[model samples]
Target: MRLIFIIVVATSLMPISAAPAQAAPLDVKGGYYHFIGDEGGDVDVTAQAAVLRNMEALTQYRSIADGSTFPGWQKEWINNLGPGVDRNFVLELNYYGAGEPTIPRPQTVDGVVVPAPDMTIQQRPGDTWKWAYGYRQVTSGQVDPLLKRALDQLKTMPYAETVNIQLGSEFDTDHEFGTTENGIAHGWAASDARALTAVQYIIGYFRSHGLPAGVTFSIGMGGWHRASFRRMHPEWLRGDVQVLQWNAYNHGTPRTPYQVFNRTRAWAIEDLPRWRTKEVVIAEWGTTANVGNQAVWIAGAGAAIKRINTDGRGFRIGTLTYYDNDPNWGELMDRDAGLEALRSVYTARPFIG
Candidate 1:
């Protein structure tokens, strides 16, 4: 489930070729996590993409159930981008959140149906949030039709020159999608195993059916939560998956670029072994309206990334995108300060293949 309230926003992977004596220079791409126009907002998708040309952008291909259908706005959003655009499209295949895995007599808030807990995954110790789940059905082949339809839809999209299909958003965060069965909460380790299996299955399914030339697939989580999962299950970062992705936000007290991206820098340079060999993406990152130094943070964000790319660190920190197009959070509208801050980064370090 994508964080619709506090949000941010994959690809078929290239085979991991044997490492060259000296890897190519890191090219850190820039873009946003969501496009407002696609969500019935006033912004124009084409115009927005044009401004951030040659960068990576994000949108969702959502499904609420095993057989849930694509919404009207999804097709319109794809059509708006058209063909021959220089941007990379990251179509997040989001499933089951906020009124999903339906249970009896769900409560409604603000005229919206509250989603029932997924009983497939059991709750574990230290779990605080009720939304976490392992997506067992998806990986178990119970929803092949829905997954296939999403791939087919992307294949027909003229705008998807380079597509990255992220399997689901932030599942590793224990509390966000924990498992439960019949009112009983169980341990989390089993669900964790299930989550990893689901990723492996999704990757194989995509590989077998295939994506377009530049498209690939990956799984994502909160940057803070990923290290724990990776440590316990080293296999999470291995195999056919070529990208290391996570949502990066400055939710703590306001932070400097160095402070904010420092963890990412560590992951690339020291903490995560073999991370240097894969593409690392800060899938979602931004400052809040009250952060005071939004422009500075925004500008510093890009500069920090650029420094990593050029510092001869052998790190592949590609794609530093913001949360969204709304003004309330890390908005990047025409008049917003974040837009210029990001544009400067894109201008200085142009997007490359």
Candidate 2:
């Protein structure tokens, strides 16, 4: 999503928490995301600089269209890196066929391999098509081959020591043809069921197939998604999916770094069951150039992140990733204030796994 650049602007900065002693620093990482297939404007050189500055987590969104070959474009720059770059890799994997019908190998339930469901594609209004499973179509068996493809590809890459797989992008605010079709579910209830089932299968599949030690799987959503849609079934937070991902963008509304932090924390942490915990990662975050003071805003955001990480709550945040624009939007690196501020945040503290 693009953050429109309007002339109206605001700026505010709240007190950042004092840094803890060096003996006990916060456990958070600074990172940046390169949009899929963006090759212009020194993108690779800029990304290399981010890593050299200790922004040790890098992500790229990969939307695999149905019947397309698995992507190896990451290797274009990754293979050229010098020794000891030491960065964790992440891929926000989105399959265009996520909501399509599938009859993969017979599904196993309670130790019995049952015949797969007999499903057919159904045509909906506006010439749209959905699988027989209806709105909730991200089934494990249907997406298994894609997942396998990802693991197999990653195994052959470098700097993929710690990998994170975000199943799909923000479905809560998803739309098609100007309508509110999430492509995953019609309502929150169905969303919960289908999401949980798909994740559980993912966890099991990863366990059986060895990849890396610190690999994590997550569910991604827009930070503005309603609390009802953010429900965390105890089943999701336990030993299954280890992370929750959200895109954090104020669109000039919250108007301050602290407000942005609180808004995101509420959705990523407070909205869930208090007893359960999972790593929260801001899969994408940014400020429009025309918005408030980008430097102060980013500094305050970094400070707020430090405050949250040191709060003794089990809300272990993984990464605060800046959203460098995709091919369609303006790049964050093009904004001097935003880029410098992110570099300042990354250099201020060390990130731990």
RMSD of 2: 11.4
Whole-model lDDT, candidate 2?
0.52
lDDT of 2 by residue, 1-353 (tens): 13333312211232235333342335577766554342342145445465437665555555332222222443466445443333333332332232333322233333544332222222234664422221223353544555466667666655554556765565444322121223423445544455456556666766788765666676656666555345533543566666766777756554665566557566545556552366677777776656655566676666667666666665556676777774222245355666777777777753532
Question: Against the true structure, what is each candidate's TM-score?
Answer: 0.70, 0.67
Clashes within 3 Å, all models in order: 20, 0
Clashes of 1: 20
Candidate 2 residue spans exceeding 4 A from truth: 1-27, 36-52, 64-71, 79-140, 175-185, 232-237, 267-270, 273-277, 326-334, 350-353
Query: Per-residue lDDT of 1-353 in model 1, one digit per residue for the tens?
Result: 55553332211233335333223434556666554553453233555556666445544434423232232233465455544322333332332323433332233333544343244431345643344222555565644554566566656666454566655555555433445544554454555565567667766776678665676665656656545435423544466666766666665577776567656556545665665567766667877666666766776675566555556565466666677645655664434566667676666642442
Best by TM-score: 1
Model 1: residue 350 alpha-carbon error in angstroms: 6.0
User: Top lDDT: which candidate number?
Assistant: 1
